[model samples]
Target: MKIKVLGCSAGIGDSRRTSCCLLDADILLDVGTGAGELSLEGLIGINHVFLTHAHLDHAGLLPLVADAAGRFRDRPVIVHALAETVAALRECMFNWRLWPDYAALPSLERPFLRYEAVEVGATLSLGGRKITPLPARHAVPAVGYWIDSGQASLALSGDTTLCEEFWDALSRIENLKYLLIETAFLNADAALAAVAGHMTADLLAAGLSRLRRPVEVYVTHLEPGWEDRIMAEIGAACAGFDVRRLRQGMEFEF
Candidate 1:
């Protein structure tokens, strides 16, 4: 499986972009402003989107992408998320006032977007990948994804705090090669990170100690301007793992 980091910043400013990832060619993990950087061809090829939560930084471009791709692709974009996350999206984002409900646009029966309310611990097959949604700690309904493509498995800690269930799910995946975890704040903002359900460098180190298997860890979702500080903190705290910051446009084949 090829994973592309379309955007990895916790928030947007300067050169930083919010969370968004492209899995292979057809699947999108989030639709943040980073998605706007994709080529038109990239936009049209996305057949599925698995959102972690309903935060604007994570799902800002969903409706626009569905609408833009509607003209080129005949099929609707399948948006998979937890039930409450879907509800939040409907009530906040897809409401007729904010954007056209593409879930019912073009036609009620055949729309450009569809929502699949995925439950925690449930695994679903999408194309060649098996996706398992895991419970996450956040201000709103959230979930992390465990993706296995028959070769290597990966755990994505969608914006979350140090949660036991998240670690438990990670421990269950065999041959887990990569962990795209989030570190949204610096150590100085530990309190803020906790309240916002985000991980700081120190918090992430504590979480890593619970893992039994060795994995290449790529830290993402950093608040802009503190990337250097957060990266240094992660390196200082965890020396046993190959930990690095995620960069936009970086593509990895695993």
Candidate 2:
């Protein structure tokens, strides 16, 4: 399986975009602003979207994606997320006030979008790939995804702070090769990071220290303007691990 980083920044700016990843071509890990980078044809080809949470930086482009691709597709795009996240989208995002309710758009029987509630520990299989929702502690109900392509696996710590259950889940993935974790702030903003349910460099290192196995760590979601400083702090704190900053357009095949 191939994983492509469409966007990995915490916030958008000149060349930076928010979280969004394309797993191969048919599945999206999170449909944030980076989704806008896709061509119209590429957007129309996406059959499934796995959302981490209801936050704008993680799920902002979903409505627009539905609106842009709905007319060209024969079937609705399947959206997989937590029950609370789904509820939040329905109540806040697709309420018709903020955006049209794509789940009911076009027609009820033949709509533009579909919702599937996923719980922590539940795994969904698509073709030969397995996507499992992992534990996450965020400002809202959230989850990370464990993408297993049989030969290897990757764990994404979607917008979360310190959570023992997340490490417990990661420990069980014996073939895990890549860890795309988020460190959204520098040490200077540690207090804000805590309040926002995001990790600072120090917090990330402390969490990584719990892992029993070594994996290629990629730090994602670095807030704009602080990327360099945050990465330097991560390097200093997580000295033993092979960690690097994730960049847009980066691809991994496993």
Candidate 3:
């Protein structure tokens, strides 16, 4: 499977976009501002979207995508997310006040959007790809994803702090080739990172210490202005590992 990084920044600025990824052509990992760059054909081609959380930066643009391309499709766009995330979006986002209820738009019998609840540890197979939700400790109900394509796997940590459970899962992924984890703040902001359910370079280093897998690591979600400082701290702290900063538009094939 081929995965393209649509967006990877924690905060948006200076041409940066929030978290989002395009898996192959029809599957979207998270629909963020990066999705805004897609052409109409690209938006209409998205058949499924797997969201990490209900955070605006990660999922805020989903409705627009559905609205822009839903009517042209033969069926409703399927959205896979945690039950809590679906609830949050239903109550907060698609309530007709913040945005139109695409889930009920036109008609309930045949709407343009549908939501399916997913849980951690459960793997969903699509054609030749397997996607499994992994545990994540975040400000809201969230999860990382492990996308396995039989031969190799790519794991993504969606806006999470340190969690031994996450590392434990990684160790079990025997074919893990790449790990895209988030380190949203600098070492100096360690206190904020803890409370905000984000990671700092120091915290990420600690998390990495628990991971025994030999997979390549790419740090993501660095704050807009402090990218350099955060990456520098990550480089210093994770000296023993092959860790690199994730960039937008980067693609991976596994």
Query: In candidate 2, what are the lDDT values of residues 131-237, reduced to their tens digit?
Result: 99999988899899999999999999999998889988898899999999999988988888878999988898888888888899999999899888999999999
Better of 1 and 3 by lDDT: 3
Find the candidate with the highest lDDT and give its number. 2
Candidate 3 structure quality by residue, lDDT tens digits, 1-254: 89999899887877999889999999999988888878899999998999999998899899899989987898889999999999999999999899889899878988889999999999999998999999999999999999999999999999899988999999999999999999998888778888899998888888889998888999888889999998999989999999998999899998
Root-mean-square deviation (CA) per prediction: 1.1, 0.7, 0.7
Tens digit of per-residue lDDT, candidate 1, span 5-64? 888888888888788889998899988888888788899999999999999988998987
Ranking, lDDT, top scorer first: 2, 3, 1
The per-residue C-alpha lDDT of model 3 at residue 239 equals 92
| Pairs of residues at least 3 apart in sequence or in different chains that clash in candidate 3 | none
Q: What is the lDDT of residue 70 in candidate 1?
A: 88
Q: Score residue 143 of candidate 1 by CA lDDT.
A: 93
Full-model lDDT for every candidate: 0.88, 0.93, 0.92
